[model samples]
Target: MKEIYSNTQRAILWLGDYSDTAVPSHPNAVLSRGEVKAAFGIAEDLAADRHHDTPEDREIAEGYRALDALLKVPWWQRIWTVQEALLPKHAVLRYGDTEMPFARFWKAFDHYFAQSYRECCGEYWLDFTDTSSNVISCLQTAIDYRRLLSHDQGLVFSVLISTFRGRLATDPRDKIFGLSGLAGTLVADYSLQPKDVFMRAIRTTITDSGSLAPLLRTPEPDRAKDLPTWAPDCCAKLGPEAQHSWDMVWFGLFAAFDAAMGTKAAMLNPSAGPVLPLQGLLVDEIYEVVVHGICRDRDEFCAMARRWQHTTETVAKRNHGVYPRGGTYKDAFWRTMVGDMILHEFDAQGTGQSRRAKASDEANCRMLWNPNGDHSMGVPFSRDRQFFTTRAGLIGIGNPGPKVGDAIYVLLGGRVPFILRPTPKKQDGATLLEYVSPAYVHGIMDGEVMKEKREPSWVHLI
Candidate 1:
């Protein structure tokens, strides 16, 4: 046991070292506006070539067409664009920067929309009636935009799931919806934060006691109706434009969650054998831990907690047989080991270490909260000074109980990866600390972590 713990600790520290060395120079930095535009232009040019003899070319063309359509939509018509337009005005209102009226903002939006439309698609007409195929083109554009902007796999998965759920509610062709739904789900899952968005959506729609009963009672098409009352309300409140935006965002979150979970799980138990079902549960648990970590830094803990509950419920699938399967127990064990090491490392580090670490974490958070500089209103440590101080204190040694556990749960279950999990259970039920020793080792000795596979078993159980 001591050897295993030591090896694991060493591996973790090594990983941190590598991460520190490599993360700063990562080539896939956030895309600049010019880059984004150039990519779009290239895609559009490729799409305009309708005489592609190959099926792949045809598909690519179709995608480009969709992108072109989306680009044509007036900035005001798109929620994201509208939000961007509103930001300056909002900032002005908040910071007293020459009070601008809402009307002025709207006019600015219109002007920007007109200019963007001309630049992107060579059109200037304001009325949709003048354009013969505006609706279809707009939908296609939205779809294409979703495809391009959905760089993150989890966000893609969430969007796909939303698309699937939406079709399940409205569309009649099961196979069409199913295929599209699966694609959307996968994309969203890979691209978005599944627990933060979709799992919560499911939990909010379906309750603990009521989850399985309705599925057993209804056909596949009607199964969604069994969802709890909050589901529809939540969906409705997101609004149509926001819904589209979230579809992409959620997919990114889901993908990240899956990747992080799968990687961590593979590292923890290299010899878990081929219990695929258990593997799925482990992935879910890893996701939960990541979410918990992220949520710990935010004041909206309850929202994150609710998200965790929803995620667990989603992964459990409300099947009694699967619920008792002990994968989550193992996941808990790994989380404890990892969480303790992270906590101890943070605690042991002086102010310099804390500042360095906090800088990276804050940068990641800012990226997550991209386009919203003042987005950390409810977070625990938003400012650089606050983040540095809080992180320094948090890294200090202490009883890894509710705080650690809460953090772990949130990271695995929340929208971000800010929280940390509690320590593992010892023979006497005390939290273990062997992994935190400086000489401790880490890394997976063996085991092929499941990568990028979608399991519908969870839905069946639910």
Candidate 2:
């Protein structure tokens, strides 16, 4: 597939015959080839509205609908098509009666819709518009990746996997196989079990980089089953609240928050079988854990708020009404709920675009108070994360339903904290730890654990 695309003068991405969803075939949806070229020429916002009462707004909205239909085609979802789209000299996209150069479509969609997906992928999980926007934005990055390839610039295996994890394949092994051109060829044996194939990829990556930073980008658990817990599963999807995703985007690896505080990862030998030896400081043990489904509606959002309020009241009552933080217990609970992460504000009086929350947001104690009834108001993290209470009064969010007693640690050369579950089993006379998931703890994100006088120790992970 790569060879065909790389050798081709121009690649035709025929979306006309391939759609993942039913599309409207109304006369209004008739975006003739000329109209497509004109739409690509449009540099300003289309004044579209859901109310569709005005003819102008309805026309604009219908136009976007046509484009969105094309973007949803399964051709955009295939993993192999990434190489197909990027390796070619020029790619032309066609759907229905519209045909335009990929570049023009990218430019036009970027102006109106791309930011919604690039920025708020998690917040708009159910938004039909953002879905199309995400596809195009990812396509643009794939093109940029081709540029990096041409420049002899290298991206780590983890970054490649983390960045494009959601792309699907008929054969599960193709998930890694499809990325071989960009990620450098791995030990390519289809006969090997998927676990072994995945393990070799991790081993190859670790050997090449000499850093376990790949492990730092923990994939959501219960995927790529039978693979060692420590080895990252490329199969994991990158959700919006994914701590590692935010860390990579908002703060470049080790630039903003180094839980290791400038410590380099141990150059552990990968040839030593599946057990990975790592150096890190054990910070705390999980005492209590909480997991909630992504709030689907205004009521669910309010219910989650009530639950948070209950937690705050519990904390306040336990502390004799004067919680020992910079603010009230309600403030602390809300901050901990969102991992103190940045959140775009939504309310009645203020423009929904007014301001994102400050890092240490004390003012959003009235967080659940969304008079505008915006579902996104208090929902910064959900679906894949679980709230947890550490043994030492630390509150944070983790993945895969953090079990009680799971040990949290700041790995050397890691960008975020990781939780490792204790096993009754031992390996080579050492206590074995099973990888739980990557975490987003509020207080310990910026080297707070490293500040403690505790020394780093070697732990064995499987």
Candidate 3:
């Protein structure tokens, strides 16, 4: 499949005969053919829109309607379309009287949305619903990859699984199989059950990245039947019990933190399945924990943020009336919300600036927190995480928030701190444990515990 697309010059994609925006203007009317620079939209880029859309929304409604019609076609919903549309040099979307370059159709829609984002998705994200398990949201899987692949970015296996988890495939196993062509990670194996396929992908991701961090991003491993505690459920999705896509929420985990401080996974898989060794330092025990509800609007997000800020202040004061690292409680809480990842794209004047590495300026983070300010900057936050404190007064955020007394550790090969629950059983003279989740605790994220000279402790996790 990779070879075939590589040799092909142009691929004519039949988006079905009913596509409304299939032929925008005409086959010759490739609006901004050379001008459209990948996907310019607020969905991923968060377009720097201080004064959104100089034109009225009614003027841009046609683009949304066109996108609405194109998304209605079945071609955009398939998991296979990821490689189909992405691998080709010139892919055309043709339907009814519509025949437009796929890039133009996709970018024009994205560009329009970016321009009028405040009017469209700024309030409720209702129109596009990027997080929802619907057709329109599913289209984002293709759009994001198109941008990634175009710029020649490395597509890691677990990140692809995280990106395309919401996509549809005729056979369940195709989830891994479909994305394998994008990056030569997993081979096509029908003999493998969906469980084995997913496990293989997890193993491959671990081997490639040399980190067990992907396991932490898995929605909840305890819920899987046959998979090990360290195996990520590459197939988790928005089912009846789920409302938000965990894939999209945790996708950033691939490049976000340094819990183990660049330590490679020094793991030993004694059996066919994975079993985590207990040779990690016991860091802290979770104390006060609060599992937050999802924020549906700007006002709700602000209100909940304030409440979280208030709680963090109380905990910080009790811990010593100051953050152990010397900053004020108010200073640290805001940084923790966004996991301290800054966009490095925006300046004080709200204009776009280019920088290659991570920026430490607090004002840039504050810029992201503004509801009316430019968000082209990366202000990554998830309402699904828990705001919790440790017995030692350390504040942090984690998923599946471990119970009050669940242990936290900088496990071997882990890029971030992991939460483990103790069990009655013991292994190899160490305490038996259950892998709960990965965490983002402030202060200790930079390998401070590993720097301390002490006897190593092993945790036996199933």
Stretches of candidate 2 off by over 4 Å are 1-62, 86-91, 94-99, 114-163, 183-191, 206-213, 216-225, 232-256, 312-332, 343-361, 368-378, 382-384
RMSD in Å for model 3: 6.7
Q: Flag regions of model 3 displaced more than 4 Å.
A: 19-63, 116-155, 216-222, 234-249, 274-280, 343-382, 425-432, 453-461
Candidate 2 weakest lDDT stretch, 10 residues: 43-52
lDDT of each: 0.25, 0.58, 0.59
Report, for all candidates in order, the number of backbone clashes: 88, 0, 8
Q: Root-mean-square deviation of each candidate, in angstroms?
A: 23.1, 7.1, 6.7
List where candidate 1 sits over 4 angstroms from the true fold: 1-158, 164-239, 257-461
Model 2, 77-196: lDDT tens digits are 888877776667888776554556765554444333333433432232233465565575575455345444432122445555655667788776777777766655465579976667
Q: Name the lDDT of candidate 2.
A: 0.58
* Candidate 2 steric clashes: 0
Q: Please report the candidate that would top TM-score against the real structure.
A: 3
Tens digits of per-residue lDDT for model 3, 162-267: 5566678879899888888776455788998887776676666556556664464545433567666665565554442233343354445435556666666654
Residue 170, candidate 3: Cα error in Å is 3.0
Residue range 1-462, candidate 1, lDDT tens digits: 222332331111100011123243333233333333433443333233212223345443443343334333332132222222222312221111113233332333333233332343323222223221333223333333334343433333233333323221232222122322222221223343322333343332122111111110101112233333212221232224322332222122222232224232111121222110101212211222222332333244444433433444454443331423233422322221222111111111111011112222433333323333333221222111001001111111111111222321111122222222223534234332211000000111111122223441110111
